[model samples]
Target: MKNESIQPPRFSSALDPIPDYLTHYFERTAGPFLNICDLDDEEVQKIREFELSNDIKWSRFKMWPEFMKSRKAADDLLMRLYEEKFQKSPAHRPVFAVLGDFHEIPCLYANPGSVRIEIADLREDEVTFMYPDHAHLIQFFDHDAPAFGVPLPENYSEERMPCWGKLFTYQDLHEIHVEYGIKKAIERCLNTPGSFVFSYVEAHIWTRDLKFTPIDHEPTGKCKKA
Candidate 1:
């Protein structure tokens, strides 16, 4: 008999064509793509509510209070994410956001200052240069990066992250299925870096049994940020 322990096939995307809006986001945005894995609109909404109810300003991050407050909120779905993953998450880590056009519904965000990174080479400073953090902004505007994350400024304000951009999302699909599209998007994002590969985060709803198929196709590149 053949080996009994062989695993079943990984998820594929032949059936799930990449939605138009999702592709458009990548094409329109200049930066290398950043996929915020395993979050849903309801939870994202709760996080936004948490931001407002607690007065979580851009520069303000007393994690303890935010933690306590989120814990107290009645939204179990939101706390399920926060209590475990985001409990110790510094405000510096950009918060995911939902935005849209007359076209798209749910776009991801990296709160302007939440993503900090080294930019000394990009600038001319004897000391290190960090934007989005030091400048109190994320520099998401007019970006052409293949992919990079800017840390939120230590003194950032919510006002700095402008709402308009080229972000698009697939609100139509169930959240679990969206993972497939995101994985494909990630593959496209890393392709340029050539040898670089990043971990594909398991979706919050992921389980061992109900897996989706991985799409085997190369990116279409139909979406352009301009």
Candidate 2:
């Protein structure tokens, strides 16, 4: 008797659709940066086409541009919130902190203080932890890591290869849906005065036998021992 092949589930099941609130947030909060970078033309067109094909506005399609603008604003707003909330925290000082016993591997072909560009080589069994302030720490397993590319003056690349694996966060991951307005919600989250500690652990596994697991916590306080 022949054995039947098992197929993996669809991507939709693996990843939930972006909530309407987040969609609105993305449109309003991140829209400006996107507009400045000219990243919304194609997305806007797609939404329009979808609305026309479905023949249902329910709300209104005219607000698409406004939503996009709001989305871009959110990114900048989030950064400001992060800085304000944690800049004075003790954990925010060192950009990279190594846990356990490991040697600090200096870049072979690059300078320390010079413009260093790190790419998350998904191909390698390495994981990177990133903070809102552009700080990153890398943890590698018993594998040959890839080389880094030289930094370019103009037209730099922000492509990062995050370790292909599951990551767990300590903070509440809220998904919001908005039908019409999200400006107030965005403002509330962005401007509200409070501090939060976020933490995460990620497992980067190339295979069942070859894998690297490193845990990271946000807010720094979460990592403290009781």
Candidate 3:
């Protein structure tokens, strides 16, 4: 039988702008680091109330907590492994290895004192890298269009851009990973030297699906089943 999947809807520059309050809430409550350590019942309840009051679907905001926890746990476990097995201090290492195998990258061992390793939570379609003073949020979107395919007026760049893809459902993200092999691909990227940071690196990979779409034809219903 021929494949009959529906192509996911393309975001045009026509959608309504996301509210600033939602954006601020996400930034403050669902962080990659701070949330993991400081998230509490009260905060979660407050967010739940906000979402309900604003008519925002809870699913859109739910992943942040799980993603934050998973990433922190992974980082903690890896750090422990480094401390016990390598007997080396991560503080001494400024460069961090992400994805792939550390052995394949000669540069990794050459600067053990300067290298820290981390495995990202591929489930989280977005990652934010923050230092003591600087921060950057990297979002993953469909490869066919500009990162975050949602449509918005050009003038709405600052407001609309920040909200782009923040509305993506977890299922949408999962489909992207399945279709693109994003998780494994990122691991491979980490293994390859020069593909990622070599010193004091804070890298975020936004995995894009490689599937092709026909302009005139819509994807079959099967595609939407994912």
Which window of 10 residues has the lowest lDDT sum in candidate 2? 100-109
For each candidate in turn, give its C-alpha RMSD to the true structure in angstroms. Answer: 20.2, 22.1, 22.5
Instruction: Give one digit per residue, the lDDT tens place, for model 1 in 1-226.
Output: 1222222123311214432210112212222222222245575455555444532222112333343223223123322333344243222222221111111101121221111111111111111111111111113332222212333335544344321111111232224334334444434543343212121211111111211221122232222222
Give all candidates' CA lDDT scores: 0.24, 0.23, 0.28
User: Candidate 2 on 99-196: residue-level lDDT in tens?
Assistant: 11111111110111111111222222221222211211111111122211111114322333221111211121112112211222332333232211
State the lDDT of candidate 3 residue by residue for 1-226, as single tens digits: 1233332223311111211110001122332122322447677566545543442222323324343343334344333433543355343211122222222222211111111112233333332221100111222211222121112334644343332223222333334433433344344454354443221212222222112111122322221112
For lDDT, the strongest prediction is 3
Of 1 and 2, the candidate ahead on lDDT is 1
Residue 80, model 3: lDDT of 42
Angstrom error of the Cα, residue 35, model 1: value is 22
Q: Tell me the spans in candidate 1 whose CA falls farther than 4 Å from its real position.
A: 1-4, 8-184, 190-201, 205-226
